[model samples]
Target: MDEVSPEETPSQKVPPWLFRAILTGAVALGGLYVLGWLIAELKMLIVIVLVSFFLSFALEPAVNRMERLGIRRGVGTGIMFLALLAAVGLFLWAIGTVLADQIGDFADDAPGYINDIEDWLEDTFDIEVDAQGLLDEFQEGGAVANLATRLADNLINLGATVLQVLFQILTIALFTFYLVAEGPKLRRNICSLLPAERQRQVLSIWNLAIDKTGGYIYSRLILAVISFLAHWLVFWLVGAPFPVPMAMWVGLISQFVPVIGTYIAGALPVIIGLLDQPSTGLAMLIAIVVYQQVENYLLQPKVTAHTMEIHVTVAFGSVIVGSLLLGAVGAVLALPAAATIQAFLASYLERHEVVQELEDAEAAQHPEREPLGDRLRQMLDRVFTPK
Candidate 1:
């Protein structure tokens, strides 16, 4: 081969340090990409673990109370678990029994109800309709019938679903038990990992997380109970069928989902009412709307103010984003997730020297100006200024 000229020898390549830096960056990027994929793939498991941990945290106060009252830690945990199981079992049994009875009653009266509905439709719209044909189409060989058949055919698949749920529950319980048992030790260990100067800050964040989460759980429980009782009373007064079961479902579902819970809870009763009488359905709808408004404006604000202090817009956005990302579990977790983010941001802003300096400067500049625009400018200035 011909000898390469000095100018064409590629300058003996770049330095090793620069090459190593490039390699390191590429490796880091690849690792991050892989980590992202893993996180997405394992999202469900991550959610389950997080939910279990938070629930355990919420239950710790009760366990501690029991321990203080002379109960052994294991026994207290067992008792708490038993109490939870019993409550859940009883609730499910009650709902199932009520649903079965209602469904049977609906079946028995369906023909008359269909006839009434058809007649009402004809009278209201002056259009004749084939009620029997519709009912028959839904009975055993129509669209609805096909769907039912498909669901029945897939009953075997339900076994897998059940197993998955069971596995998740067991995992959660195991994790929760350990969390409750070793909560103090875990906290101590976590704190011990921090430098002496940073430990206080870390401890403060931990305490804030615990307090906010615990308060949120307790307040939500109380609110759910109140909502259930309120709705139960309304249904009882209105003479709606299966008021107790419906109310209980409203409570439980609402506890899981925040703003939208009332609407969902109202839907069942309204549907049932429509199958009974149009006037009944209308009344149920009105009651639901009124109750939801009251709860949103009055009850929710009072209960949540002391807990998370998240804005309504933040709450709604969080729910929508979370549901889009991870479905029902995410929706249920949206508030806590938002609250946690808020806590972190709040803490960071408070502790950041630049932020503090800007805040001080703004406070010094505007001692009494409360005009909306002035306040907005001041806030922007504080947010953007350097230390």
Candidate 2:
């Protein structure tokens, strides 16, 4: 007659097996937590290893071709790294010399440009703008002063970022060199540690990744060259300074770097174009915009679909996810990673029609409870029906 507590009920008893199970689960969860913490600590190293792997995949085709041409693998690796270093050095040198000069020239020429803009505005729109006055107001309002104060802060932040990036690049270069030079031996060593079936599977996956990564890089290189030529023509015609280097910068960055690279690549050329004339700058901007639109909406999708055999939508999504996980390097690596994953899954997952996972839950919640007579009637109808 007394109210029974659920905890005291016979079915509610904690058996020795259940207790052991709970303890085991708790210990497992704790171990997982520790593992997660350790991984977080090693995240930078993990990113470098992954990026290095991706780069090695991308460059392996060139190394193989060099070998086929009678070059030793070590020499081929050296040649690849040397080329990479030359490009990086050029980029750095251009940034230091050209960019620094441009900034100073910009500061000197800004007032003249402002006057020309004001004169044009007055002539065209009857808007007698005081651009110089506006700039003076901004200066007086502590805006320029604020910029001066923050310049040091920005420089410090930038230096730290550059060092971090250089470190990552160095790690990737070292790993890529080793992978290119000793790939066959490395594969043999790795395979020796695994069983025969696992070794075969690992090699298969590795080969697939290399193929996709090589294809991705090749496609990008082709596009980059086209972009470079197109921009070079534009820059030469417009009389922008350093047309060759500027075009190379735009082409490589816009083609290879993800998301915001287009704007960064286009900015210098556009600014230099403006130094030639406002119309030239506007033309440059328009051309860059149109080209980017074509690349994003047409060229990129077609190339990726053909080369990596990945849908544009999947490639775009993977880039977003990868960028969120590991910033720019992740975005660059994501497409090939997605392709590799698709290839790997295709080897294992069954081909079947899919159903929603929640369907069983819904069916359980809304069970069809029928009367015994109704069930009998249904059974009788089924029995009487033709097979």
Candidate 3:
């Protein structure tokens, strides 16, 4: 017989389990991929629903009170919604009027401002600046024409974007209205599907969520109103133009937007005051700094301690994480979300009293009596030493 080549020999039979294992893995991977794709597609809808849920939680207490007073839930929700709309409309109207007037005034005074700037430069630095020449060069470069052309080209896209935004707003409104109006029914339906123990637990969690979310929002609103009044008084005293709108801007931004909001809110009034009169600007700046300090030390702690009960560091970290995950909307919702989670965890999780030694170590002592390094070392020893 001819010598058989290695290639011609029959291959060993594949293991049945190995084949099944590989097939199962492939199916599992495909399923995960499809799930991820679906989640990505529905991300916006999920966000909208979350927003609606939070709005409902914030409005539930008010609606409940109205219901107890013999008003229908639907009617109460409608009334609340209309009041909110009216407040927002008034704010927009005030801001718009101020902005329109300012823009017109600025346009008319443009040449005078340019001349003043040129004179200041020449007097202070001996630099002869040609403001008109720069403007002429800019116009000559056809930048204005190009900008106009781009705006014209993108007009249709802008309109489409506006329409899309309006649709989303409508969707949010409808969902929020239903959630608030039918809240009791919704809770009952959810509880019906659960066992008695689970139903109790779920209802407890739902009530906790409403308390935390509503408390957070109402506290912020109170702080915002206080801030607005404080700033408004300062602006009026300093003779700042558009004081009401500017104060409102400061209050809303500083309360809602974290981190950089105070600076941004303070900037407009300061700039406008400087343009009007340097003394006014200086006074406004001083007032802003003073008010910020007061708010930080006095106002915020007192208000938030009762309502939010969230640590500053935890709140800041939550905002950062939320912004990273979902942008501005995430940041706005983070505080209430964090408060709810914190309240739930606090209620559910067990706690133990601190040992005497640990409590004593944590207690503040005079640095003169105990050196800082020694105290730290003692604390570390106490923590790491064996029982």
Which of the numbered candidates is closest to the native, going by highest TM-score? 3
lDDT values, one for every candidate: 0.80, 0.83, 0.87
Better of 2 and 3 by lDDT: 3
Candidate 3 overall Cα lDDT vs. reference?
0.87
lDDT of 2 by residue, 59-102 (tens): 88899999999999999989988887898788778656777787
* Predicted candidate 3 versus true structure: per-residue lDDT over 1-387, tens digit per residue: 999998999998898799899999999999999999998999899889988998999999999999999999999999999988898888889878877887667655666787889999999999999888645533534454256677889999999999999999999999999999999899999999999999999999999989999998888889999999999998998898888998998888888787668898888778877877899989989998999999999999999888888888998999998888778878888888999889999999999999998767766552336788999999999999999
TM-score of each: 0.79, 0.75, 0.85
List residue ranges in candidate 2 displaced over 4 A. 1-13, 113-165, 292-306, 347-387
Candidate 3: where are CA atoms >4 Å away? 1-24, 137-153, 364-387
User: Which ten residues in a row are the worst by lDDT in model 2?
Assistant: 137-146
- Give the CA lDDT, 0 to 100, for residue 121 in model 3: 98
In model 3, what are the clashing residue pairs, if there are any? none
Residue pairs with clashing backbones, model 1: none
Clashes of 3: 0
